[model samples]
Target: MKAKKIERKVSIALLFSITLLCCGGGQSLLAQANPAVFQIFEKYSKQKKVTLLEVSEELMAEYRIKQFKSIIFEDGTLALPEIRRCIEQDKQDAKKLKEATADGLVVSGYYRLKTVDPAMNRYLIFKVGKKNKVTLLYIEGRLTPEELVELLK
Candidate 1:
């Protein structure tokens, strides 16, 4: 009976170890799959201005973002006209990711310049309430506007 109990305990320990290994591996894979996004989040947290062109090609390619520019709110506020200007450029229709009220707006859109290659330039504008906190990200890439929006979402 003592030997049987010891064997059962060992088996349970092995199973638990396997489970932990699998779970940890899965999480690492997910993080590696989107290194660009994770890197951007890290930069944002540090309140750094990240230029899309400055990012590594490998990281940018992972997100299909060929070029990216990012800005964070330093003074905790942005002017409404600036936000409007972002929406108006290229006259492209902006998609609302979040509702706009007395609080703020989260909008994204893309436009292509009249170039031979015709690379699409995408922008995501986020403003949080009256606090004037905002983040604007510009991405120039091969992905369609819809795909970019999905990626940002």
Candidate 2:
């Protein structure tokens, strides 16, 4: 009887642990999966000639996006190199969905990050435009890879 009681207790504890992980652990996983690009946003968002847009999931529901964040640097003279380094680091573990290069440098790229939740998809998109302007975008949602491409159009 004592052995049975111990087994039951262990089962309950295990179940409770799994419940907590399913309910509360997803956010931490998402944050952990975010690339180093967030540093760029924090460092440059308040600077002059920088534009930042962060839209909540609730506001982006119509677009099927759970989260949307973008930062644009008009003169990327300083930030471009940092952004490139971050992207290179992020690309190490991500799937390169699309990419463009100019003068042997990555001018634009789209990547799908490995995520814990199959229901949630995460992506990183970056571009370098005229006058060295740079744009970086991060998106999360349930959209398929093909759907994301369509939405970008």
lDDT of each: 0.50, 0.88
Give model 1's TM-score versus the native structure.
Answer: 0.42
lDDT of 2: 0.88
Distance from true position, residue 14, model 1, in Å? 78
Query: Which regions of candidate 1 are displaced past 4 Å?
Result: 1-56, 78-121
lDDT of 1 by residue, 30-51 (tens): 3223212234434444544322
Clashes of 2: 0
Best by lDDT: 2
lDDT, candidate 2, 25-94, per-residue tens: 7765655466788898888989999999999778998777888899998988788889999999989988
Model 2 poorest ten-residue lDDT run: 25-34
The per-prediction CA RMSD against the true structure, in angstroms, equals: 16.3, 4.2
